[model samples]
Target: MSNADSSTKKFASQADLEAKKTSFIKLSDNAYAYTAEGDPNSGVIIGDDSVMVIDTTATPLMAKDLIRNIRSVTDKPIKYVVLSHYHAVRVLGASAYFDEGAQQVIASRGTYEMIVERGAQDMQSEIERFPRLFSGVESVPGLTWPTMVFEKEMTIFMGKLEVRLTHIGMGHTKGDTIAWIPSQKICFSGDLVEYEAAAYTGDAQLEEWPATLEALRAMQAEKLVPGRGPALLTPAQVNQGLDYTKDFVTTLLQSAKESVAAGMTLKQAMAHTRKVMDPKFGHVFIYEHCLPFDVTRAVDEAQGIKHPRIWTAARDQEMWHGLQAG
Candidate 1:
């Protein structure tokens, strides 16, 4: 069906009103994953004397649920709030952890710079796109700024547990960060790896994504908590999650490159992508929601746009309608 079809047309950032059932899974002795169906995920690392929250939900009000889960098992103070990346849905709820004894809000230097560059625009853009995810948006004080920013990788000790947070390379976003616990052989890969859900590529670096995924694979994580989907509790599952993400991104970019080589318009490229990906990924969560943006970004990269263009609410509509019109 054409994007103009009223009945089947799904807007880029439209609403999915159904509340996703959340899963709070223990990946290891110290690590846990909070995932909602196919919505974004947050990771928890309980250290010796304190705890760390990987990504906050959307707003302070929404983060209460995750905090409750953390409180159930351990009463340790929430010492660090790590932004897997600077996306609004992932980082905006950081304020909620301060009362839990949070001392530092952590992110990569790349992520911090992105917040400075487009955090405001992305805030409006995301709230408008995924309205339900941000129903508690009013509770957000403002953009979440990281207090501790790292360049390559930094290690934290939870008593004797060695937890390392690293920025291997850019995949989902330029500043994507991952948490690794060496003792447990567990990795909390932010949005870099998705198991059953489509990876959001609106702000992604398409060309470099695969190599970044490979870097994650080299970790040999025995357990992994991906950005979405259920928590992976085994090495086999970890490899599966990695492969699924790599396949999706590589296929999307290749389709875009082929379309560009043949001089296909954006709309035509969308059609081409659907023909190849639909049979494989059509039924996955948010595939419809993410495909257009994925194709748009992939096409841009193929045409030599290295840095992803900043997305604003106004630009969101323009691009949505632009795709629909043709």
Candidate 2:
């Protein structure tokens, strides 16, 4: 079947789209994280004077659920909303936060630039790639632009709460950042740490992923809100999340490198990878959506490509066909 046909098969029905809603999981005192049935995760921190929301879902309509969840806990205004990365599914919902009186929407300098350069393209690609996540596409006003951009790291004080935004290194994306609460030992790892989910590495720096995880380990977090899956409540579970992420990246890179060294096509590489990864990570969230893209990008990077190619709708179709053909 053609890629266009695959698109029809993948998203012809919006059954999955109808299931997105906010799930309030309390991480600590005066702190909670909002996760949809499986949408992008958002965090809420209620300080002495105001509030800070970590990530906004994908659309204003989707963010209303997060807003409603926050209202249940406190009436304090959302003073800040932090973007963990530049992915449209994560930041496009910033407008909802703005209406809630969020004083600043923060991201790293590289992430800010990415939003300007490729955010629109990414927005289009992702909407098609994961239709369920962008349920109310019309609700998105425009590309999500960051108001406050940081370089290496920035610590913002919301009343007495210290929210340390740190650029540990490039892993998931060029400008990946994590929100670390030193006192509580809780780290809101963007896509850097995934729990029970496949790590999406289309724009990932696979070589640098292990080191980024190492930097995260050095922080000794007792609790963490990973990019996906359930929140890690214990240090052991946090470490498990980090380890699983590292293992997936490492194995993917190995499969790609080996397949390319023997002159195999991207499809053959994916098949080999599927054989190796199925018993372990095939059950993870988005494992199928992420693996083909992950392995395809890894093969290109292993063949000496420096930067990841821009993912357009046409390219997505092409890649989808390649996967289906195999």
lDDT of each: 0.90, 0.83
Which lDDT tens digits does candidate 2 get at residues 1-326?
22335545452222344664467999987678776544567778888888887778888988888899889888889888888999988888889877888888899997997887788889998898888888688999998777889999999887788889998999999899899888899889888888787889998899888999998998999988888777888999999989999999999999889999999988788888888888889887677678768998899889988677888878887776777664
What is candidate 2's local distance difference test score?
0.83
- TM-scores, all candidates, are 0.97, 0.94
Who wins the TM-score comparison? Answer: 1
Question: What TM-score does prediction 1 earn?
Answer: 0.97
* Range of the 10 consecutive residues with the lowest summed lDDT in candidate 2: 8-17
lDDT of 1 by residue, 210-275 (tens): 999998888899989899888998889999999999999999999999999999999899999998
Any residue pairs clashing in model 1, and if so which?
none
